[model samples]
Target: MFQNLSERLEGALKVIKGKHKITEINVAEAVKDVRKALVEADVNYKIAKEITERIKEKALGQKILIAVEPYQLMIKIVEDELAQLMGGQKADLMLTGSPAVVLMAGLQGSGKTTFSAKLANQIKRQGRQVLLVACDVYRPAAIEQLKTLALQIGVDVYSEPENNNPVAIAQNAIQYAKANHKNVVIVDTAGRLAVDEEMMNEIEKIKKAINPCEILFVVDSMTGQDAVNTAKAFNERLDFTGVVLTKLDGDTRGGAALSIRAVVEKPIKFIGTSEKIDGIDVFHPDRMARRILNMGDVVGLVEKAQQAFDEKEAERLNKKLRQNQFDFNDFLSQIQQIKKMGNIKDLMSMVPGMSKMMKDVDIPEDAFKSTEAIIFSMTPKERENPQLLISGNGSGSRRKRIALGSGTSIQEVNALVKQFEEMRKVIKKINAMQNTGKKLGKIFGR
Candidate 1:
């Protein structure tokens, strides 16, 4: 996502490298390069020109600090401008009504149905009773797809297989939600291959009927400039409250995310990070700008970690680690939590400077597959007491059985056991150091 754009912008910023001050000639060179980068990234030419002009003006007018390098100062200006270009602050979905109706709108294949289920899962996690209403009656399997996703996320779905009227189905779903005490109703509307009068009129009618609290225009971010154009047309008709940029994990040039808000005057409320239902993230413009600049998003990474880690489970694991009793069971649990946090490369990219370091490294999604398979093949007792395989000098048969069960080699099993023991020893040493510190504190009475 934005990989090419990031590299281009980095090169553009380097124009001021080794410069002592921000002068007209160097700033113009930098601005020209930046404009070219935006155009190559598929950003709208007019919007790109306007943004670069603003950046140029700010760069020339501001006073440079003696301590800050020229390149650093230019980066700061561009970051702020990028954040403002993509909406200066985060925009949250408005869910105020008793059953807030959020209508999803976009062209066909924009991921409306999937994003609806993702939104339902997100709202459900907020302690709200979310009901997903499948209103795409024209599509044959759209309703079924939504139902499947809703089931995976443990959210209720409302649909009428026999009814062809989307408006009526939406109304009925609202009534059903009211009766069933569902607090949020997400209406997934039908979309056309292209914007047509009939499709626009139908969605407008549904909007009028539902009186929705929020109307989100979901767009495929990989579509580049086309996504921005589609957004303009939809906003001209539906006046959507926010935008959902789907497929951000794809090979996106990031034109839609950077240009849609400037063209349509709307905030991007959410971004689809992956194909998983749990891959949704609230759009944060500042964090995204930092990421685009290769500055990393530590706050976003911490939030993901917090969401993935359970407090009670963490406390239990901490106790076991302190007692030197951590085993494969606990290890497997931790692995599952990390897997739930989404893609491994994405997670690691959030660390400062890791993005550049991982550019050429190919970290597969199933990097933990072998480790997990080995652990799952273990018996309950064996999992609880990993020493059974790692402690003895002659545990060849046990390792061989585990290898066969997990479809791995005995050498692979041996390697895993060796790594696990190494981790255990490190944890023990850390615990011992902490214990020594505590004892010394008690004795010194400080």
Candidate 2:
């Protein structure tokens, strides 16, 4: 995420904190800081300058409005500018044809194959039959990887490994999809390490051969400016209809995401986070702008939660929490839900103030592994009633066996069980306090 850019912009706005109004001098300092922050974030210098200029003009024009505080106004200004810079509106994939042929283009390792499977899963979720076509003839393993992903996601993959010509393979894949009544065909083409004439020519030929409805250029956001340059090169050759920004879960400076649209004039249709099939999110400029301002993207967060939420399971867990009966089982279940939500770093960064407050901290991706180990070590009954193990020191012979079973040391299991017991006690106390406070509030209201 753009954690660095977010922090810097927050600092820049602080320069005009508590001001009752916007002045040219104050706005100039803040805008300069914003430009500098963007530049430091690896954003194109020209794009950064152009954005700040637009922001300043908007702020100055709105100076007469006294409704919002200076800081609030500044945030609003930045949000609008950011949204405008990214794209004022989200773009949709052109899926008009009976088999909406999507052509994927990028340099090698830009995540084309993974994105095709993800998109297939997405369209399948929409109740459309999707056929993931493997046109990466150059890499023998790519088709296999795509097939595995398709199977995991419950989507069909069309591959002709014996065919060396990608254009022919793509054409055959579409024919197979049509024959099978599949309505969506995602054609994954081969990519070179860099934009080569041969690769470009092949992709362009495949595009013409398939007559695709959408040609999506996949770019690795981790590559920053290089990603933007690659998009430009690809767009010049392929004239892609949309962009898929992959590896956005990484600590990308966000330069590519910021500059690609301005450079290539294409809407970013999707963003890829982890390798998981469910890790793709449709790009939204407004939500992204909100995130960049350290404001919690409640819309995006709820969408993520809804996607991750299991209604029956959440209701069961809520009952346990309300009854002060939450245990290691519930904790483990929650961890699974969180894992399904995609990269922990990217997820946490969406929470307002979490990324900033935890800047110096490191939360490993294997965050739940230790806890999972401890929980697995517990007996079925112990997981349900953790108090016994907690009160028994979790050091008995049975406890040691449980720990060994879960592949964790006895001490770590003990710590986990102890924390769970302590948490239950804390919840009970908080509930009692809240009940008493509610009574007092009612009396005061009366």
Candidate 3:
């Protein structure tokens, strides 16, 4: 997720970071490095040059305060320009009609089908009845793929397996949505390996027939410069309402995200962060710019947390923590909640200063597999009362059994038990301190 670009930008900014003041020579040096970094990241040479020139001008024009350093101000200027380049603010989907039709468009293998389902899932979560329409009658198993994804997200999908007319299918799907009381209908159209006249004409017909409120051009962000070019072609014909960049979780150099808006003149409405149905996110240009600069996105992190965690469950956990009753069951529930927040590494990178530290660190998607296995192997009693495995005559035997059941070593079980015990002790100490503070407050009341 722009990891290389982040590092390069950091290095570029270091040129003026240590300087006592800003100067034309230093600004030029840093701007040159910044341009090179953007180019290496697959950004168009012209866009890179233009952005760098703006950065240079802003950097030289700033009246540095006594407290503000050259580098700090320089970072701020770059962040602003980057945000402006990516479409100053987030562009939301316009669901205007009674049964708003959101059409998905893109080349084959660009993730339109997957994004359609993801978008459906997102809208469904918002309490809207979303119907996913499978209009991709060209590609093999395209209809089946959409159905499977729709099933996974528990959303209704409208498809006519026997009908080859995508435009008719889309039209019928909208009618079905209207009759079924659906609020939104997302029509996933067929795409070709390359942009062909037939493909374009078919999508155009679908658009004209449906008169969709929003036509999203889904492009594979991993395609780099080709993504920008493809977007331009599609925008020329369809005049898409917005862009959806997929595969941001892949080895993307981030050229598409940076260049697409400028070239296609369309705001990026959403980003496919991962392959999971819940991995799609609304694009926020300022947050992404901060992330590219390694400044982290605390707001985005909090938003993810809010979406993943339930208020009732959080209150229950808080009560358990206050009473020092946190156990393996509670811990396992916490792990599940964290997993719901998306990729572990991506979540960590959202914390300030963690991105650079985790750049080279390989945190696998299944990092919690062993821990989950160990927890699952434990008996209900042991899960409820973790102290049962800490200080009893049969504790060692219980641990041995758990290790065998979890396919782990006895030493691993011992390490987990020790860590859990330490965590409980810390919780107890915090609870005790809180109680003492309450007592002091009651006694000192005037």
Candidate 4:
């Protein structure tokens, strides 16, 4: 996820670490390194050169500031340029009309189908009645895959499996949506291995028949420069309103994301961050630049937390913490919510300075599996009253039983109980500090 590019850029910007001013000599050296880094990251050589030139020009034109370091200023300059290259601002989907139609277009294996379901899920979460239309008549079981995804996301689907006519399927889907009162229609069209006259003509015909509000071209970011070329062809034909980059979580060089918008003259509206249905994110260039520069995306992290954590459940947990009643039940519920927040390591990397610190650390995806299993093995009473297993009366026997039931060692069970108790104690300490703060406010009488 741009990790290599970030590390290389950081190294390039380090040229001005000890300098007090942004001199032309230092700027040239930095820009050269930056250009090399971008080229190595699969960026178009011309675009990379052009961007580095702009960065150099900006760096030389800026005055030395007393409040900011030269290296920090260089980073800011590069971040701004990168963001501008990737569509200076976020572009939102135009979901207007009684049943706003969005046509999906891209080459095969570009994740067009998956992104369609993801888009529908996103709109459905926004309080809209979304109908996912399956028009990929050539791909075997493409309609079934879409139906499965729609079912998982609790969205409706309109498909004519027997009818191989995608153009008619899309038109009928819109008519079906209008009759069913669905406010949004996402037509997933068939894609070819390579752009051809037949494939292009079919999608164009579907576009003409549907009269969609938004036409999104989904591309596989892992495809590198090929993705950009494919996007250019699609844009030339369909003139898509926006772009969607999928497989961004893979080991991609990120050239597609950096070059597609500039090449096609379209904004990147969405990015698939993970394989989960909820992994789709509205593209934000500024936040992306921050992440690439090791600045971290705090706002994005907060948004993910807000979406994953239930407000009512959090309020209840706060009350319990204040009362020192934070039990295993609440702990289990918290774990479930955190698991829904997507990849653990990716979530941690969103915090400031954590990405660099955890670069070499291997955080397993199943890190919480053992803990969850142990807790699930516990009886309802044991979960409600963790004290029952921690008390000195029969602690050892109870732990052994838990270890056996959970298929874990006794030492692991003991360690989990100890960690849980420590967490409860920390909550108690926080509650005490809050109480002390209130008492001091009363005493000060200010």
Q: Please give, for residues 244-313, the per-residue lDDT of candidate 3 as tens digits.
A: 9999988999988998899888999999999998999999999999999999999999999999999999
lDDT, residue 197, candidate 4: 88
lDDT of 3: 0.93
Give the least accurate 10-residue stretch of model 1, judged by summed lDDT: 190-199
Error of 4 at 48 (Å): 0.9
lDDT of 1 by residue, 1-446 (tens): 67788889999999999999999999999999999999999999999999999999999998988899889999999999999999999998889798889999998988899999988998898899999999999988998999999999899899999999998999899999999999999999888644588878888989999899999999999999999888888888889999999999999899889999999999999999999888899999998998988888999999998999999999999999999999999999999999988899998778867888888899998999999999989889889888889866546788899999999999999999999999999999999899999999999996
All candidates in order of lDDT, best leading: 3, 1, 4, 2
Regions of candidate 3 where Cα sits further than 4 Å from its true position: 193-195
Displacement of the residue 84 alpha carbon in candidate 3, Å: 0.8
Structure candidate 2, residue pairs in collision:
none
Candidate 2, residues 269-367: lDDT per residue as tens digits? Answer: 999978777889999988888888888676787788888879999999877877889887888898899888877777777887776776777888788
Order the candidates by TM-score, highest first — what do you get?
3, 4, 1, 2
Question: Residue 224 in candidate 3 has what lDDT?
Answer: 96
Answer with 1 or 2, whichever has the higher lDDT.
1
Error in Å for residue 436 of model 3: 2.1
What local lDDT does model 4 show for residue 225? 95
Per-candidate TM equals: 0.96, 0.89, 0.98, 0.98
